[model samples]
Target: MEQSGGPRGPEGNEEARAAAHCYRHPDREANITCTRCERPICPECMISASVGFQCPECVKGGSGTGHAADANQPRTLAGGSLAADPRLVTKVLLGLNVAVFVAVMIQGDRLLDELLLFGQAATEPYGPVEGVAEGQWYRLLTSMFLHQEIWHILMNMLGLWFLGPPLEAALGRARFTGLYLLSGLAGSALTYLVAAPQQASLGASGAIFGLFGATAVLMRRMRYDMRPILVLLAINLLFTFTWSNISWEAHVGGLVAGAALAYALVHAPREKRTLVQYGAFGAMLLVVVVLCVVRTAQLTG
Candidate 1:
């Protein structure tokens, strides 16, 4: 008599096993099973554990002990928790810049006008007024990711790819992100304060220059050779002064902010490292805000 509901044949069993789906993502196939829970997990759901890969739930629950889940997690040099993907923040920032560049390319000058850093100006002559002085403060932050020219985005993204990952790895994601944004804000504030009120500026060059300064500080902190970065920075500064269309204010402002912030982040006393680092960030942000406030007064007065 034929077996009723018996075990599957070898090939059938293999096929059934191969068809297993991730518990978290039903649509996705999963081959690796979580060591802790024995749940099938896709790559995205896999978390490296002491013995083998674990699912997010298992990892979050720890090793069935009373200890904190991340108690044994590694820490970065700057006392931040080491991330599974050290360059994740860098990748996201680069992607944002590229995405903005693509959007600008498709939408043309209208999008650029809305995003660019400007003190006070209209999109066109006699058009509805815009710019930071007119309460369009978002421009200061948005302009950091905006780019018009292909070459401009290319250069900035290249700098980010090279410099960002190392900084992110060293300082950890949150601090690195803070450094980039505050530096960019510092640049925008300087440009608003000094440049012609109606003058327009947009680029990641400010943030890139900020990365340069941070890299120098990080290298020095690690006792690495200073000559290479110094030479590179010198060349960039020369170009900043000599290049006709370049905004020297943005470059200078970003460089100073990044250097100062990196110094505090890497050199803060270990006893109060977190407080000092965050305080430095707050101070930098305050400086940027103060500059914008003064400039706004001048423009609106």
Candidate 2:
């Protein structure tokens, strides 16, 4: 077909020149075609390709994948970061946990009494007097990010380092972060239910366990090996059961919550995946809140 601004063929033989125009700009002349799709593209619409220039569509699809991705735009994901920087969520979460741990170390033993998950229902409150009477519920979320010991934070962060990137890349930053936090909250909720109200508990282990459960479930859906994760979980569970100090309730709660959320996220319908996943997670959070409310009622009653 004759392209815009294309000259006549030599010797008046118009059939000798096969002209192609840019798909987007039908009026613009295009000589070079995309290597992947073989679509004609004008220089203005071309992007630098390893071999040759590619059309905008080919680049958006990812350099390797044939399918197209969304146009270049920053999207909000978990932890309120732009979509391109999914790793940022993981880094920030890890950084916060480390910073809190450092603060705990510097502040000495008193910090745990103030920061640990201590229910208002406890017979004798361990957290701050203002927190207990004022219904400072932030402990559930804050406790998930706080750790007292070097080895404890190190182990949990190590688990996050191994498990975080893949999940972040797959689920996007926001969803992954939501999973981590909700699982942590669930852990605190369960700990509140079973542990003594005055009992002091703190650490990211609950959140870490949640990540473990999510990774294991997602891997199973992908037909990936689950043995390693299962063994790890089992060993950890054994430690929780055998150890005098370990909060088994929190571990169990986080594992169950993470696995449930992972299941919802993985099986969510492709048509409304994000909506369904978040809605389902919101329902799960509601359940946690209900549990907290009921547990608190029992304590107060």
Candidate 3:
């Protein structure tokens, strides 16, 4: 082809001549060609022989690198970061939990009591008062993020930081977040159901414990030996049972919920993914509902 400025051959114009000059020195003049528009691009613009000379337009259209990543393709943890920064997300979650814990503590016992009870204890004549009653059933979800003590929040967040990343990396952020929240709700519901009707509880331990439980199950699915996980679970269970006022119900419930959620959410194909995820989520919700109903009955009866 020809252009107004000059012929469009390899060495037709000043730009082409310069490109040829560079290419000749490198003994690569034969491979320079515009990939986009096929304008016989100069060596300066030409990428290489393997991919051909991608024209400016083509490069722009290609967007940054060479091509867009497939949306469905799962991304592996890159740059050794998968392991090095494994706890990065967990750290952020930890910070949030700690901050909330402090805020609850500084607000004093009156506010702390109401905060711990959330909205469920609103009508109760004793125990912690519920702060935001009515339409705040959402607190069951939010309560997982609020802890009353430094050690309580720290322990939970640390557990999450240690345990959450591997699962998150395996499952993707969206699924991992969903499991955490849902598991926390399940944990809280179980606590409320099994404990004194007026007892108040608060902590991220339920969600963190859920992550541990889920990881244990996923590890098993991945063909890893379950000895270490079993040991850890046993230790946590022992602690729960031995510790006074630890809300063992929440711990065990969250653990089971997390395991179920992990089983449903991880390593599934697109077609069956929805079925598994929704099924697990629905089942967990059903358990929570049953617990709530049973608790309500016990209180009324």
Tell me, by lDDT, which candidate is best: 1
Which stretches of candidate 3 lie above 4 Å from their native place? 1-72, 75-89, 118-136, 267-270
Which ten residues in a row are the worst by lDDT in model 3?
72-81
Instruction: For candidate 3, report its TM-score.
Output: 0.65
- True-structure lDDT of candidate 2: 0.70
Question: For each candidate, what is the lDDT?
Answer: 0.80, 0.70, 0.62
**Ranked candidates (lDDT, high to low):** 1, 2, 3
lDDT of 2 at 188: 89
lDDT of 3 by residue, 56-108 (tens): 34454553233333111213211011122434566667777777777766776
lDDT of 2 by residue, 130-241 (tens): 3332376788888888887788889889988877865675466678888989999999888887787767778888888899898888667655457888898899888889
lDDT value for candidate 1? 0.80
Better of 1 and 2 by lDDT: 1
Tens digits of per-residue lDDT for model 1, 1-301:
1111223455533443455766666665556666655656554454544344556565565652223433355345566666778789999999999999999889998888889998998788789888999999999999999988888889889889988987886788898999999988898899999999889999988888999999899878755568988998999899999989999999999999999999998888766888999899999999998999999999899
Candidate 1 or 2, higher TM-score? 1
Clashing pairs in 3: 35-53, 36-55
TM-score of 2: 0.72
Q: How many clashes in each structure? A: 0, 3, 2
Q: How far is candidate 1 from the true structure (C-alpha RMSD, Å)?
A: 12.1
